[model samples]
Target: MARNGRSERGATIIDVARRAGVSAMTVSRVINGRSSVRPETRAAVERAIEALAYTPNTAARSLVRSAELRIGIIYSNPSAAFMSEFLTGIYEEASSTGARLVLLKGEGGRPPAQAALKRFRKSALSGVILAPPLGETRSVLSAVRSWELPVAAIGAYDVDGVACVRIDDRSAAFEMTRHLLDLGHRKIGFVLGNPDQTASAERMAGFYAAIREVGGVEVKVAQGDFSYASGLVAGEQLLGGDERPTAIFASNDDMAAAIVSVAHRRHLDVPSELTVAGFDDTSAAVTLWPPLTTVHQPLRRLAAEALAAVTAAASAGSTVATCRAKILDHSIVKRESLAAPLGGADARSDPDA
Candidate 1:
């Protein structure tokens, strides 16, 4: 009798088990690279697998391994919009890896580092992924060291012994600033990012570098915390001044959107009376009436890469002692929010101009 389509495809675990004179579970364990199976049983299963041409589904095999491995993610960033995208990336990769992700919540009244340590110690986490602010702190890295587990830092500064995956914040910021300068924007205003995160400092440095490169320009800066609320305050401060800038470059999209709102209330037409640009081409950038001109940071891909690094390190155990860093590229996305200042920024030096 001819075989059906399903059976004709290839040999299944059941066939391999029968050939090896073992149960399906035993064959599965052998196929999944489990170390607990008896040597003789494993040998028999291997012979059966080879003879029957049995091939395991890669995803199913990952699922089997994941059933045993658990990973933890620690974060302290205050931006809800940013964190949402960040977490989604981690979760997707974890699922693909066949590993369970444990979100380690606060423990005791201690800081994020201590809380992460407590939760990590209590759980069976094979590895840890540290998000910004938390990842940038030396104390947190020290705490992570005590655990001796594989550690990966995403969107954090490169440390000596921890794997890191990030985009060049300084370079991205530099390009965005240069883009604004190219559009005849000299008196450009800036809104700062979160002070606790290292990326904030890098971004500020980039902005300054761009300003120095074009010495004949004027610049103003307002402190912001990478939140919509902080952006609003920063926007008011920058726009309310008598020597207001013709262009504003916020460190993040939320703040840039807030600047647009401020410009609207002030009866200034965006890109005509004022031009705005931001970093992190996040969702809020496009949702605005006039889409923002910004830098595209691949946050999701960065998280996925970070998770892969940590998981690989975890699986490798002590053999992988050295830290590794992966730097991804970013691009400047032009949109309706930016344009050459009316006439020229130098020509509109007067506050009302």
Candidate 2:
């Protein structure tokens, strides 16, 4: 039974199905974590897999297939820092798997994404990966699904029939807010990301949740489109007022860096007169004078995971059926940008400090 020093008669999906007394499709559904499968059926499939030592041959299938694997990436995110890290992840993964990547800039609205999908329809693309904002766009998702292309979404949550990879934005934001609160910052300002993305809403929700947990805290909200320019405007609005916040948390590092710039212009010492925090530990977070205390969102890993999921689904020739959601981990990164307020826990009494 040995071939090339390995077992030639290795277990396959059919073998697992036969051992479990179920159809191959049922086994596949169980393997992909589809909710439609009954608990008993899922358990049986797991038991069969364990007993037979059956492993899905994604790599072998890809190698045997004649068509080259081409993956399309459509993105419209405004943050350059975020995109740089995201593309790095995708490139790294593609190089390892020998998958070709086709890039498309979806700057406008649904038209760009839809147009990209239309172009990909004729390009022999094996699958597509939609970056944030575009990933959450209903029109774009519907259009891609209509074309019957294997698709995965990055930074989007709970999209039916699509493989999704993201961190818990709400939870991450909540933890970051808690960190500021623990540092004795009572008056805090928040800079929001683009309104079109679901992550913006989730992050805002987390900020409010933490704020609600504490009483008598003053909070100011400003809008930013996750761009450095937008961050500058938001930072000005937040710091220009007479009753300024003791700390500010931006939705992303770009905005946080902008806030730092604004603070320096106003002669405020970071972590002394004012504390700043940001989400997504992108390049901007560390490059600034004082490193940002922020949420560590694995932008590159998210992109890589999404690409891998869609490519694997395409390899199996059942993208929609095999699509699954994966939630990655996020952590709070502590750095010099955050500290206790100037007057510590009693800073609120002065307000002008």
Residue-by-residue lDDT tens digits, candidate 2, 50-169: 998888886766573556689888887777889899999999988876688998786643337565568767877778888887788887788778867778888887888787788999
Model 1, 1-353: lDDT tens digits are 88986467677665676699864545655766767689999999999999988877676556646566677888766566677788888888778767778785443312475654776668877778888766777777788777888778887776776777789999999889987777677789999998877899999999998878765678889999888889999999999989899899999998999999999999999988899998878888888879999999888988877776666555434312226467889999999998888886555333332
Judge candidate 2 against the unseen true structure and give its global Cα lDDT, from 0 to 1. 0.83
> Using lDDT as the measure, which candidate wins?
2
- Per-model tally of clashing residue pairs: 1, 0
Model 2, C-alpha of 212: deviation from truth (Å): 1.1
Cα lDDT listed for each candidate: 0.78, 0.83
Question: Candidate 2: deviation at residue 191, Å?
Answer: 0.8
